[model samples]
Target: MRILRFRAFTRPGDPTSGNPAGVVLDAESLSDADMLGIAADLGFSETAFLSAIEPDAARVRYFTPRAEIAFCGHATIASGVALAREGAGSTVAFTTNAGVVPVAVSPERATLTAVETSVEPLGGVLLAELLDALRLETTDLDPMLPPAFIRGGNPHPLVPVAAGVLGRLDHDADAVLRLQDRKGWDGTIPVVHRISADRFASRNPFPRGGIREDPATGSAAAGLGAYLRQHGLVTMPAEVTVEQGAETGRPSSILVSIPPEGRIRVTGSAETL
Candidate 1:
């Protein structure tokens, strides 16, 4: 049982700053409980297990320290890069619980295609609760972009805040977890500020998955792409960049591309650690 650790979404020339994920290439022999135990032992936000289903295609499962999630973008990127390093070809199709995520690999980076994404309205009551949980007031939120429940590979309630407020995202872990569960969100994505029409800064608090925060969240990035496109926040055929992990001092970036009509593409670099 060889477990490989890789740092996903690392900044160029800075391997130490990225999101870490565990990859188990030969996971066919491992059961669900075994995967859960391994993820808990590693203590990463998510770990990916791969089982060969066909040539250039594999069945991948994602598990957090506490439970299994439907999808994980960073882990998928890490696994695809791992497979490419092992001669799996330039492209791999991952049959995930959410959907089939196709990843295109290159020597320098990997790009993952997300599932269908949607942006739905956030209820008034839930929005208030979420604001309270994060210790934010309505005035602190971005005036142009109201909060909404964005669903890509997973569920994220994205709240856009004013400038200078995203750096102070501190709250009770238990209370935040409770709020996520109650609102049926996998995590809360508080976008600190929009640097430009094509770039933004964000922080994702994922207490429900037994993690305090994610340095880089690919799924959330994809979700945000969908939100921005749907709301006309950015121009069509948009390519957006999300800056994350700076608050944790592990700065990382995720590139998201939203086409005319299809799954969004999230790209990033990974390094073996």
Candidate 2:
């Protein structure tokens, strides 16, 4: 398998490394073990493998170093760009572990419409557990947004922070991993730092999937959009763009749209290696 690596939100990583994305177009030949091993070696937040099932659709899978995620935004963006580069520019459906998500591509960017998932308000035990794991108190959280566990294709905890704290992303990777492994949390303990009345910058601690932080997470953005709309934090006919991974130096952007009916639209731009 030929794996192409591209620097997302930045070109060239230092010795510390940027978010390295692996683009595998002809991924049908790779076994699950093969994909997992490749992802482990690459050590990116997520590696996307697109297996062509027909002329228009592909079975897309995302692998982290430790496990296979149901969905991934950065990988999807990278894969969509790869497909466009291969001259498959039409709308394509990706059958993910979460569900079938449709991706639309243009030369400029790609937008993904996530298959909807219901929202279960999280303010009791699950919410407390997540807060304790992240070493944060409820006082530090935005009371207006409250605490919510939103599902866009997967699950995520939405904790809104005060404005301008998004760049302060610091965590013990092992501690995060310990919590995820022990507690079986799917989405990261998402830190909604730098959140205004509407726009926000967020970070995801996805140790559950063997990833420490995700630069630009489309899935989480989708979930966040849903959470915002469901709780009336951000009103309808509004779109908020999220900035992530600036601290780790692989800055990424996620544009999320909230419709009047509370559906989400997530968009991002990608490049080829």
lDDT of 2 by residue, 1-273 (tens): 568775443323333323457877778888989999999998877788877646568888888887887887667767776676667747878899988888886644678888785666778876677667666667767666667777777677777765544555465677667767775666666788645655677778777776667766777788888777777776677888787777766766677888878457787766654
- Segments of candidate 1 deviating more than 4 angstroms: none
lDDT of 1 by residue, 66-168 (tens): 8889999889889988888878877889999999999997645799999999999975988888788887888889898878888878899888888888878
In lDDT terms, which candidate is top?
Answer: 1
Cα lDDT of candidate 1 equals 0.86
How much is the lDDT of residue 50 in candidate 1? 93
TM-score of 2: 0.88
Off by over 4 Å in 2: 7-19, 164-169
Which residue pairs clash within candidate 2?
164-194
Candidate 1 versus truth, CA RMSD in Å, comes to 1.3
